[model samples]
Target: MAMGKTPGSSDDEGDSAGFAEINITPLTDVMLVLLIIFMVTSTVITQQGPGGGTKTGLKVNLPKGGSADVTARTTDISVAVLADGRFVLAGNVVAEAELKQAFDKAKEQNPDTVVIVQADEGVSHGTVVQVMELAKQAGLGQLAIGVREGN
Candidate 1:
């Protein structure tokens, strides 16, 4: 045996100690699993809430016989669609062209506020959708369509 040499190795051998390497396979697998879980959960959360509760904010007549009964929060921004095709925002009548501006102002005032869409029974579905779309364009992600309780 020579100096700094293993007993089982021949004299012609060099440095027998190999380089140390870290095995990150397990870490990478765990990270990928966690990423998948987060992606699925995020999609579910963005689609809808648990019970799909809706809040009302105006005198508009809502359709009856809904399973859910929800009340409006005081801080919520109200956008009302009247039967005459006019839009009422926060108790004041606003023109269709100003709808997005109104919603944007409301959102700026309360960033955490949700938009409550109160559409009368006689209002067209397209009008309601337009209001909701304007609210979305104003950066208001949270919204609820109003519905009245049935007898």
Candidate 2:
């Protein structure tokens, strides 16, 4: 009787070694997609400004002034006075009568809250002062005026 080769034994005709190659194309594609997602999110966060609050879309021509340390804080409230005598608080249009109430609510949240007034150059001086006065009545003592830095 002739003896046949064992089933577990490797012969010269067939190599039993499994595939050693690894495909990295799928991994690379997933990593690139994640990188793009992070890039877009970071840009949106930065554009929201330091305070991370919504900014008004009004096109106000800010007055040019000398540079100063006017960094926005988390406890700061932004108010925009439009040339047409409209008041916008934190990106929402509010009536003049309700402006004081808004400031009062902000003061209730934080006693050290600072009110930043951003009035257009075409707005009347009295309008700006009146806004400041309302903030004071709301018990918000800290106030700031927003201005564009002159070259």
Candidate 3:
């Protein structure tokens, strides 16, 4: 009787060759854990800033490692932003687009005027930022945001 070759088998019976794609579930799990860790750590880092006290939404202890910067004197101009995006200075409601001129007038009277920005919790961040830009254009060197001490 003659020996016949196996149709689908390799001639070298003892050797094996194959390539297979592996699933990425394990890698995905590891990335998710790292993401969670970074999220928690970032929250902790922003908590403490200069002045030895913590205010709501403001930095507390000085940021780590980098040289600390001394902030310039804030001008005494109070810009109150209401919840509805109205810009008010000294109790007068000013339109959002007219802030530059108003700030110029304030600066002309007092060069040392510091712009203090006060915003309600319900007010949008964009409204507050607009007021800040106006203060800068008004020729004031100092800009500070007002925040509650606690809560």
Winning model by lDDT: 2
Q: TM-score of each candidate?
A: 0.55, 0.72, 0.47
- Stretches of candidate 2 off by over 4 Å are 1-21, 46-59
User: Which rank order by TM-score, best down to worst?
Assistant: 2, 1, 3
Across residues 24-63, which tens digit of lDDT does each residue of candidate 3 receive?
Answer: 9999999999999999887765443211112223322221
- Which stretches in model 3 have alpha-carbon errors above 4 Å? 1-75
Local distance difference test, per candidate?
A: 0.70, 0.79, 0.60
**Candidate 1 colliding pairs:** none
> Which structure among the candidates has the greatest TM-score?
2
lDDT of 2: 0.79
Instruction: Tell me the deviation in Å of residue 88 in model 1.
Output: 0.9
Error of 3 at 82 (Å): 0.6
lDDT per residue as tens, model 2, 1-151: 1136554566676754444457999999999999999999887665554441435555678899889567777778888889898988765689977888878888888998888898999999999999999999989999889898999
In model 1, state the lDDT of residue 24.
95
